[model samples]
Target: MPASSTDAYITDFAEFVQASPSSYHAAAEVARRLEAAGFARLDERDEWPAGGRHVVVRDGAVIAWAAPEGAGPATPYRIVGAHTDSPSFKLKPRATSSSEGLLQAGVEVYGGPLLNSWLDRELELAGRIVTDDGGEHLVRTGPMLRIPQLAIHLDREVNKGLTLDKQRHLQPIWGAGGDGEILGELAASAGVPAEHVVGHDVLVADTQAPARFGLDGALFASGRMDNLSSVYAGLMALLGAPNDAEHISVLAAFDHEELGSESRSGASGPFLDDVLVRIGAGLGAGDVERRRAFAASWVVSSDAGHAVHPNYPDRHDPANRPVLGGGPLLKLNANQRYASDAAGAGFWAAVCRQAGVPSQPFVSNNSIPCGTTIGPLTATRLGIRTVDVGVPLLSMHSARELAHVDDLAALGAAMAAFLTPEV
Candidate 1:
């Protein structure tokens, strides 16, 4: 057979992740794709258009949707939600430091990352910089830094459990210089005067490019797979769905989910809620109609789920182990860590079946605690029935993560089915 949809999906996903080094870039990239698809940009401060495709963006979040031509105010939405931010190191305001004649950038760990995986890797700086004149620029310095690991001879006990101090060992060497040198480089790259650089939100990322690996290239590895994979999957599904579908199809990519999602552009904030309300108002909806719309709507919170590790078999639940390439997984937790319930899960399973896609179930081992996603928060805040699902992945929060190429395509199909009203 010729190249399957999975092959094409993986190819596009690799490019998306490489282009999106930070949340700001990720949102901008999503906007770029939406605009290319004939979606008009809508400013939050301006009145929303009544129908057709439109998109609204906040700092690091984006929401795009296509309303049915004759849809009423009570028409529910088929929404797919994902996060843009991943675990990485955020540069400090005063980010200049030096030790033993080596220049380093002061950094703070953002969210929970596998610290050891970042050591000894070539790194690059990427994020948004705000100029004094209110101009915001996305800057990227490819392969400009590294965080070298200490020689094993110096720490003879390296074979044992390794511990890293966030402030001490996690700083990445940028070269021999202070803040001015770094600022000058960023200014030149961003094409702005150094004096006009009043603020910045810079972060470090692995410089390694994404690639297909393993026998037959079944496995794909790259950085920022924790959530970007889901983001891309959702985008593809939204763009591929039938335009004349009954329900309004929405794609919501939020920011700061890796950091507990408390920011204005995060799931726990008012971004999604505000947009929904505005959309309802633009459709001539009253409070009751808005509530009715939400009550009838559904949201699928897509993130990266953990795959059963070959070496750590005992860590996964015996009955609910999820494996890469098996299929997309429906995440569940009785404690509400995930919002999936019997009805929501059934709905998703039916969507998968209709799409001719396979799916698996995932539950944390009784002995281990589970991680939370935006599913529960979206359900609670919007009063919309929600389910949590994802493609199984390995080395989730590491600088480089792995997932099966087949599973990526399966997820895209499943999401597209969910967005299709006929399904």
Candidate 2:
């Protein structure tokens, strides 16, 4: 790709990160972009058209597909899988509380977040609120909260090793010296009545905007890039690929991977399979034909991987040291934690080779364990060949993470190659 196009891709990725603070917001932003790309919105209760670019949103999950005119059930699906949610703090019920001269918001740690990274940063409460009338509204408080770390004076050993109590120390201060409901601001942002908000699923999000920095503007930093990088890459690849490929191309962005992917919207659930079955039915496929399609289908499970931290090089496999801007990583594990086997690795290598980009291998150190993605779960559920791949990042789950602009574009190119047929 040209430098101009790479610059535009980075700009668009920054815009995507800014627009998506929570999983719900990520799904909404994806649907918005899909519609802008001429993909029609789909409803689950309604019958689907046989052939078209269609997308559907179920809670925080989205599945979009392009079925050519003569596509059938036996036509294999080339699926690009990623998640929408990231590690963050979630608001607790009756979230208001008080500390020594400040009003705070009670929250629970949602996933494996680097607790120290969240300190002293401005944050926003973002998610969906359900009204008494059963209407759902998206809400966000731009910069309403802050989780302040205890000063060095208060904790003399802070610099040596900081320890935080999740319930007591992580509550964010939203106001000084009085009780205040954070929901009021969320309601105001969404233009909804605060009293009508009967239920909510709110998350604390870092308010920092994504940026490109460093000596030559090669480094990109942002929150939620762990999975959003893959999500956005898959979206771009799916939309830009030829519509008349031999396989039905689908982009499956699920929620709750950080929470072990057990929920209905996660990859462990039937969301992707349900959509594929419906599409097969529309193509006059019975159980056997659908099984045949499943036999031939492939899913590229794209997530974020470690890029061999500079300060902690020993934490990664010494033989496979992937650096920033070193193209995308093909994640592998002997325990099936990443679901990338020899066959999947070969396939990904060929795809990246065809796309004219370098591919790096990533494996964890012997003593240290690596976090898992939705790869094995998706493969187990759908019985499809799944490959684990992603862009290399320095901080895996910090409030703000680091990535490379070149690697982001390279991942997108590889995804497009994987989804398209015959080069």
Model 2 backbone overlap count: 0
- In the predicted model 1, the residue pairs found to clash are none
lDDT, candidate 2, equals: 0.91
Give the top-scoring candidate (lDDT): 2
Q: Candidate 1 — what's its lDDT?
A: 0.89
RMSD of 1: 1.3
lDDT of 2 by residue, 101-149 (tens): 8999989999899998999999999999999999999999899899988
TM-score of 1: 0.98
Give lDDT per model, in order: 0.89, 0.91
Clash totals in order: 0, 0
* For model 1, the run of ten residues with the poorest summed lDDT: 176-185
